[model samples]
Target chain A: MSDNKSLQSSRREFLGKSAVAGAALAAAGSGLVLTRMAEARAPDQPVSNKVRWGLLVDAARCVDGCTDCVTACHEENGIEQSGHAETDPQWMRKVELKDERTGYQLSLPMMCQHCETAPCADVCPTGASFIRADGIALVDRHICIGCRYCMMACPYKARSFEHETVTKQKPHAPRGKGTVEACTMCVHRVDSERLPACVEACAAAGHNAIMFGDLKDPNSEIARKMASEPSRAMRADLKLNPGVRYQGV
Target chain B: MAKMKNLYYRNIEGTSPGYWGLLGALALMIVAGLGAAYYMEHHGHIVTGMSNQVVWGLPHVFAIFLIVAASGALNVASIGTVFGKQPYQPVGRFSALLAMALLIGGLIVLVLDLGRPDRLIVAMTKYNFKSIFAWNIFLYTGFLAIVGFYLWAMMDRMVGKYYKPAGVVAFVWRLILTTGTGSIFGFLVAREAYDAAILAPLFIIMSFAFGLAIFLLLIMGIYGATDRELSDSVLRRWKNLLGVFVAAVLLLVVIYHLYKLYITRTHGIESFILLNGGVYTSLFWIGQILIGALLPLFIIFTKLGHSRFWIAIASVAVIVGGIAQLYVIIIGGQVYPLPLFPGMAASSSFSDGVVAHYAPSLPEFLLGMGGVAIALLAVLFVVKVLDILPESLGDAVLNPPAAS
Candidate 1:
């Protein structure tokens, strides 16, 4: 009986070792392929100042009563609805406008303009609020003490504070309670050379109102369009030099 | 010198049931406040009235008021030692003590209300040098230290000579401190209600009025509780000074509003605050102007000012008015929608172009009251342990012949 038990134990050990070796081999193969793919796509480098990402919104093409972009942003960012409209965090929203005298109406999506000199970054006490080399304003949650001073300083009112504890957070966007957050312009996707969720969603919905590209790259489609068309920055009087421009508004 | 030699200071016997009851109540309030703060921190600020729109609420108002009053409280010491006013000299020590107490109280509220209260150590360590909030941490701590040294110099005969220099340093430091506080709001160019240079001096004048009112009330309360002899002359002088300070504040308010009204860009904000801002407008006209400014001014300026009861009423009025004024400034400023689109009405899910509503919850009110209780309790504890209060504050003791 003892000899039979030892034989069974040895057989089980051998199977476990084979399984471990197979898993390790599979992981190594994937790692090598991923490295090669990354190297082939672009140099593994930090965000550089060479590329200044921006968005151009054609208000004329933007449809009224459609929130595909807003919904896409919420889903991509994992921003939940807490059933409290007044206190929920909104990274992006559709703003409806009406000219009082003209009776003309317009609809456009508003988010962080990603200014060259952001007021939110200027007022952050711990330097937790900062602008990246690529001119993306972001709050470093590690350092953000949640004073909300940045929200008060924002000219566009683009920032929102996470009032409730966030249970589910997207892997790319780490959100929690007692922190300030805003439209990152989908920095995660931007770094990966992919369009922001909102921009893609807008395009998918056939509005094609939003255009995303590098402002620094003159040959870029967005840059060419901007050069040809007259576009205005919201609250340009503040001299924020917002990356987002609007046309036909 | 003869009167000084005759004057005696002693600690209060804190054995009475009444004294114990008062201490117990204050301690209870402080504990309640801490509990509320902890609940808010654990549950998140969603439990409070503060939101993305109205970022600051009742606690900020209380904290700012206490801090402003603290700097103003030291004015008595400055007048006595720096300006060489003999009559004001007797209250200098108490002024320094109260200043420290009020500052400690205000700072507690400010720190506790933070979303990351546990990261207070981080705030102390890391700093954005350009930020006014960073500058204020240094200003607040420095004010406490300077006042502490000034108090020692005044109380200790060995370092008595240092009193004048210490007083001068503290006076200058306080001016800079109050200026920094005002600049917290004044420097916000995004907000139409702020971004004015006059706000600095306006806050200074406000500090003078608020600080004097609080000081007067403390002195009166202590004197009455101890059954000590307080001169009618000193009370009357303080009353007159308070009247002058109130008038100065009212004048500054008028100028600030008029300046906002004159600017075309700020006209919308000015009209909103003064006319169409429903609760805010009423708070300005009825709460701040009538109850806070006008009634207090009337009490202090009239023959009723002679009575201690009336003077106390005026002090209470001033404090009430001060809260109303802050509410209008902090909450009212936020409720007025930002003009994202000029000549166009904006509507959004984010409450854009609509006045944001705020109703401070029980926890916020308790937290603010806890700050007030902490200040009072500190005074109580200090007086019980140290001979901070004089046995009698009669005219003879206050105005010595040698000092004159």
Candidate 2:
């Protein structure tokens, strides 16, 4: 008789807790609807020019031997080395620079600068090479034709051709043989309000040399830094207005 | 003036064993070239010497040479029909046939070399108006159509009046086509070697030299094989013309390099090509200057100029030199390191600050040779089927009947 009474009391307690949880959810749902009505935009919209993605690299803080960013990019993009050094595709790489006069040396990662007026886009025969609304330069493989004309046109030499057939590929980054590719600024992660793999890895390694943010927002950290510090674009004489900027070289 | 009725046009009889042997050889070459192309497609471009550093290779050199030569071959018809030169009229039909054959060969090589040959439909349908390559698609196709009409106009007496008009249109079209080809490299601002506008005219002159040299060889070979009598006067005129074109090409090359040397920014590339570029420097001086230009010029201008054999040798030399020139231009242009940073030296795992290396593979060489074979095969087949070649290109047939 005591066991039966204990089971009945436990069932009664569960019913009481369920009633209170239901009431709380109802209230929260109404609040959420009201919040949605007050907002000016939808949650799922296409990328727009209102947000211009940019990267600010602090050369002073960029460690000479740290390859965290390059490693992160390769891992994230599924770029593999084919053991052929000269023919293999490299979307991102670290360049070592030495001062001719003083023998001082520095190292920094180099990639597609994502220029507003990209030469690759201009020379592409099928209009496959294009700049996104958010200023990321991209090649639409559907019509690229693999002529390598865009590769010849790029000034940074940032682009690479897949010389061999590719088997394994990340779903978000589709790479194939005979097409040209370059850095996409991790557009997939950026869409989900997550930092790019390179930027995240740089920070995780404690260097904190790379900053990625919206260049259009004046109050954003990257914009504020650009305004305060005298940063320059690579090959500024080309006047390509690259989205990526460097504070020191 | 009475219309001449004795100018006979007869097709070649293909019953000879030698003719069949020639055809068989060319067929084998085409099959090999196709096989190589298929291998490249299946295995990817890694099989070829081309890399991210050297994007273009020996196949490009061959394709460009043939394409440029095709445009120049049309000049004979233009001079005869459009310019109203009497002596060139007898060879006009053959000239048109040669142009068509060469262009078809070049187009085959270019199409086969594509990274995705299957996507040729996309290349045709999709249009990038700003791109010179896109424009070339139209130019190339238009050339084939115009030349076809020009050929018909020359061959058929019914459309004889259209000959001059067709020739004029074809002439203009070819000039534009060659300019477009040259502009493919010339418009590239990233490469220090190719930015100049002069490449347009330079290519025009190059076509004249290369096209005429091939034409002379073809005429000599055909006449020799058939036991046809080719007059010395006719041969001499062609030799002199070839010599003048070769000299013009040499002068333009000198001017192009000299202009580049004057620019401070281009000094690095200039010095690399003229002095420090190891293999490229030797090719420029020896292959292009000595074997290609000077030797041919010497042979054509000397007492040996009277000999048909020496003239033929001179033509062969010009062709060799043309290949060497294109090699330095196409491959050499890419191997040089791009100056990404103005003053600072750059080092990367990708060979950023150093010169890139390239060596053409067997497949590339075979594919290039295949393009040549395709041209020869086309000429062989067309001559056997159609009455394109005249019975005699002698002075009697060349000059009109002294105005009745």
Which candidate has the highest DockQ of all? 2
True contacts kept of each: 0.75, 0.77
Chain B alone, TM-score of each model?
Answer: 0.97, 0.97
> What is the per-residue lDDT of model 2 for residues B1-404, given as tens digits with 9 covering 90 to 100?
12444567777777789999999999999999999999998999999999999888898999899999999998888888788876677778888889988998898888888888899999999988898999999999999999999999988989888888899999999999999999999998888888888899899999999998999899888877876656678788888999999999999999999999999989999888889999998888898999889999999999999998899899999999999999999998999999887778889988888999999998988898899999999988998899988777666666546674
Model 1, residue B229: what's the lDDT?
Answer: 83
DockQ score for candidate 2: 0.74
Best by lDDT: 1
* Cα RMSD, model 1: 6.8
Q: Which ranges of candidate 1 are over 4 A from the true structure? A: A1-44, B1-5, B401-404
Per-candidate Cα RMSD to the true structure, in Å, reads 6.8, 3.2
lDDT, residue B325, candidate 1: 90
Tens-digit per-residue lDDT, A1-249, candidate 1? 789989899888989999999999999999998887674345457677888889999999999999999999999999998888888999999999999799899999999999998888888889999888888889998888888889889988999898888988999999988889999999889877789999999999999999999899999999999999999999999899888999999
